[model samples]
Target: MRPSLGRFGYPKSVRGYAVQAPGAPTLDVFSRRTKWLQKERAARDAETSRKVDYVRDEVAARLCERLLDIKRHFPHVLDLGANACNIARILTRPNPDSYSAAPVYEPLSSRVSALTAAESSRSLLHRDEDLPFNNEIAITRHLLASDETLPFAPHTFDAVLSSCSLHWVNDLPSVLTQVNNILKPDAPFMAAMLGGDSLFELRTSLQLAEMERRGGIGIHMSPLADVRDVGGLLQRAGFRLLTVDVDDIVVDYPDSFALMADLQAMGESNALAGRDVPPIRRDVLVAADAIYRALHGNDDGTLPATFRLIYMIGWKEAPQQAKPLERGSGMVSIKDVLEGQRTGGKSGNR
Candidate 1:
């Protein structure tokens, strides 16, 4: 069944998910129906889906690692856009190698009381629903829902986590606000999304190839978030104590065809709205492959594709949360301390 359209042409299925707060701009940059179809198609072949989940797995592990650093227990958590349950799997059966520094293998589920895995694609969600998880440790519930419109009550969760899913969201700021609203006061929200020059090599190669062949370019890659703007978004969403950082994960492929194929399997193919442009000409693909090799090929004849991941952490505002001291409350002037250090602890008057 096809998803009906709502305001700004969003999927009608998402209307009941949540009401968009007033004044929150609904950007129609992505086609939710197309995204769902892509994910559903990707999940059709289990083996191919698993093969392309390496990037998601890595990001989930890293996100969980950060979550583990917090020395607090989360009674309930939400895994937003939980494709294939990557975060759930990591939390339930954490790899001992990832935490070898610890004295023992402690499951992240031990700290999280319960988790809800919400996904936009039903096929992808069901693929992992039957996985043999230790239910006594990890109590997970699956929900088919859109990340663009979170269907949850206010202050419903102790924490919210997402891995490599927010990038596909059309109205990111609105979704972030929903995430903050659903999280309890002072609860943590941790997530990672592809952004900031991700797939630059392929993007550049495709543009150049199209320009050379067709004398024009098409939108080949989806636009991603910039790391610099993420902090501001968190603050705008009413989140405090924000932290944002980036990491690059490069994977080697035999050629551009292999890379594109893997991306399709990963359910990350371009789903930009109004992308009804004609299929890329075969000649352009040929030229793009050649250009890709010439530009970013490795010494061993393999091509390297970079996925830039932006990791962000923010906490819901709470009255009891720690706050910075009032302005000018410092006893010592920073300038004086810097000058003293510059003068080797000697007074400037001397």
Candidate 2:
């Protein structure tokens, strides 16, 4: 079992870990977490992204060719937290050539109606059940809400592709276990999730200001777990062909408050279940905004909010002869490993 952590919880990047409340206290000095939200964020994520429908759909289109190459014979697929059903939308509109890499595409999603008029689906399975599809299912962005475990059979899916999810979950190792069990030998699993440094400005500013105002400290923002952390997770999860990539998009906002509102709009709020909940008074909120502007704002009074995204691609291992190395040693060839340039971590291990 992992070691116990206090109110701030554990993640490498969390700067201020103050449990005691600040100088001018506002609300009750929140000792324990109040009523639990019961992992209710899933329903909220579905409802909010309708306005951003095109973004997901466009993501699918961009990955079409690469996704096609991952599997042959139209492997059974499952799209998780499939709010927009964008994969189905792109599948129907195949390239000009009559022949493509995929066979009959099956989209099993929660919001069944979200599938475009042109797309097809096998069945609608609940997120907490054994998927309706027999084997070789693909999923994305579904189980990352609150570290809730996934339900599926071992060695099931031929390949899994997840786009823009997994940042919210804390049970990285458990999630990887489910992935390894459900995926077949040597099957590919690729995903895109926000990285630890991903919304640095937005996350750090909020955390610091909260610390400064309330004299209390706990991770207030939705802190991102980094790429190395993810790569290590994949290794522990039993994936062999592992590759993690980042796409850092620095989004500009007029003010830090505007950026904070955008986070709410995206339904990506902090959900540290069993965390301390101190009341944030009106003045505290006002002070936080000012400090956020002071630290992260640019010369023209605009704040730079970084959205560093990580694209990870890994696969279950096919049976091979084992040539054991030293405990901390690797059998990998160095030249072949520098496949892509990456930041952070010691050398190019990730």
Candidate 3:
């Protein structure tokens, strides 16, 4: 007989692993920002915020391309992150009325329509906690919510999209499960999040410098999920027709300090609970800066920072989607195929 799985089908030993453990306090490295409206502060930070939005715009555009390729119109869409409602703006542009369900009354030049548009951080919104839109594009609901806890009915949306978010989520699997539950069967769910390799140059430089200056390294960066883990995460969350891809974006900065400044403006600075209680030592920071320049410097005297984005596209599971074949259902043997290849068949041509 086969060995049975532990709770949640995770191995018993793995139950203690931070990534696999459900509701692990240690894994909650990111907490809701307690600062005074960080999003507003970021907006005022000038070019740094624009640089972060450049990445977000790329993610939003890629997601919109996929959505458009699906061809079928989505009557109801959900924007999970909705930071400045970028995704909705992309979808509704070209012609907002092309997507609107209503007949001509007055041109809805100031609004667009959506089933739900939610922002995890309320501070990201403008005066009324909403985007400035034409009357043509009206959002039915503007929710101040997080991915970890989506307050919506099950099978509620025709399509769902998230951009430049989900990397901050601590319990990724649980949030994915919640995302799955709210999506209608066969509906599309698309997201882009930073992958494990993001800021590797910075992380390595800091670690090496810290170990040399101090005795050991501290938790300077939050742990991010790898591209390899995403496919399984989608399947585990009851999503099929799964597709995952990686996009590596590298940006150059004047120095490590410049890079750190941009990260702060992006609101993506380290937030690990177990990070060093004391402030980082000046010597360690100085050493790290030197190391980063020495290793990653460019001809322009700048340094490159890599942002690895993992894009995921999945559909809520339904009977219509393709299924894997059952065991022993193959019509041809692998051994026979190999023999044919050796005997001057198809495989010999290459």
Candidates' C-alpha lDDT:
0.88, 0.53, 0.73
lDDT of 3 by residue, 125-211 (tens): 332334344334656546565547888799888778888778877778888888899898888899988887999999999999999
Measured against the true structure, the TM-scores of the candidates, in listed sequence, are 0.86, 0.60, 0.76
> Candidate 2 — which pairs collide?
21-215, 22-214, 22-215, 136-156, 136-157, 136-158, 155-181, 156-182, 196-224
Q: Which candidate do you rate higher for TM-score, 1 or 2?
A: 1
Q: State the displacement of the C-alpha of residue 126, model 3, in Å, after optimal TM-score superposition.
A: 2.9
- The RMSD of every model to the true structure, in order and in angstroms, is 9.8, 14.1, 10.1
Candidate scoring better on lDDT of 2 and 3 = 3
Residues forming the 10-long window of minimal summed lDDT in candidate 3: 104-113
Top-scoring candidate (lDDT): 1
lDDT of candidate model 2 versus the reference:
0.53
Query: Which lDDT tens digits does candidate 1 get at residues 1-350?
Result: 87877889878653256678878567799998899999999998878998899999999988888976789999999999989988888887655347467565577888888888889888887776666773535555566556578878999999999998999999888999999999999999999999999999999999999999999998878899899989999999999988899999999999999999999999999999999897789999999999999999999999999999999999999999988789989888888888888888966533
Model 2 reaches what TM-score against the true structure? 0.60
